[model samples]
Target chain A: AQRVTQPEKLLSVFKGAPVELKCNYSYSGSPELFWYVQYSRQRLQLLLRHISRESIKGFTADLNKGETSFHLKKPFAQEEDSAMYYCALMHDYKLSFGAGTTVTVRA
Target chain B: GAGVSQSPSNKVTEKGKDVELRCDPISGHTALYWYRQSLGQGLEFLIYFQGNSAPDKSGLPSDRFSAERTGGSVSTLTIQRTQQEDSAVYLCASSYNTGQPQHFGDGTRLSIL
Candidate 1:
């Protein structure tokens, strides 16, 4: 079985400050990690995947095999970046998601 | 449709009543999935349908939960004798194929009275 854990339930930051949403996972086989975001009144959407190794909306996540972590980071937070973020692990086409973290960016 | 579509954005029903939720996957997508999101359980996979093959129902919480996809496009999830614990946001998602990134719907909020 695979599991994803997000230690933080909520994170608050001032505009222009750096932010990080931590995520950890436990899986026996190779793991595929992804970050998904849900904006207010909007559907959940894929933010980025570990395989892609690309940044989206100034956010990036690095998959660390030794630590079994895939933490999402943004260099500078923006008001528009406030949203609920979920970390997920895929195994056999089924995704196991973390409890999620709500991010608030204050002006 | 352009993206995954789910019907009945919100539903409130008696505990013993049966309820059905619908999901319309993106056109040409071969993989569809159903998940339940609750305050305590986060997101739990319920079932998955790939093309016309037998669905993977291993994630279903109980026998009272069942789902079916017809013509490999639209899927319906039926809960029999719904219980208060069944109240949650049921979400539907689709991908072009297994291991592909999924696109999700707004989800249907089921409230059991």
Candidate 2:
């Protein structure tokens, strides 16, 4: 079965500092990874996908087959960057999500 | 365009009572999904509906949980004899088709007292 693991439950970073949310998955087949974000009082939205290889809101994630990881990263975290982030693995037409990481960008 | 919409943004029901959560997928979206968001469990896939195909109930936790999508647009998840453990945010999402990015709803926070 495919599974996603987000090691960090919570992360606190100063404004303008770098923030990295670690995500690792286990899947026998080729994996499709995605990062979803949910802001306070907002619906969960797609942040980025590995297949696109394009950064969204200054966040980018690279899928590493060797490491089985697809960690999301942002060079300079901003106040609005605080949100709950989830790493998901898509397989068999469904998604398996991680426990998620709550990031807080403190000013 | 409007995103996926879920009704009863918040629901409070007593244990042993039945509750139904509604999900209205984005117009023109043929793939709809149901998920449960617990305190620390992230999002757990509950079911999937694609067009007129049979729904996938493999992710459902128990017999008390069931879902149905009518006319391939609106979906309703029914939980019979709800338990406290069922108290969580029920989320619904929809996509254009397979392998497409899913647009999520605001979610309905179900609280069982």
Interface RMSD of 2: 0.8
How high is the lDDT of residue A13 in model 1?
A: 99
Candidate 1 lDDT, A1-107, residue by residue in tens: 78899999999999999999999999999999999999999999999999999999999999999999999999999999999999999999999999999999999
Deviating ranges (above 4 Å) for candidate 1: none
Q: What is the lDDT of candidate 2?
A: 0.94
DockQ of 1: 0.94
Alpha carbon deviation, residue B22, candidate 1 (Å): 0.2
Supply fnat for every model shown.
Answer: 0.94, 0.91
Clashes of 1: 0
C-alpha RMSD of each candidate structure in angstroms: 0.6, 1.0
Computed on C-alphas against the true complex, the DockQ of each candidate is 0.94, 0.88
Q: What overall lDDT goes with each candidate model?
A: 0.96, 0.94
The CA-based lDDT of model 1 is what?
Answer: 0.96
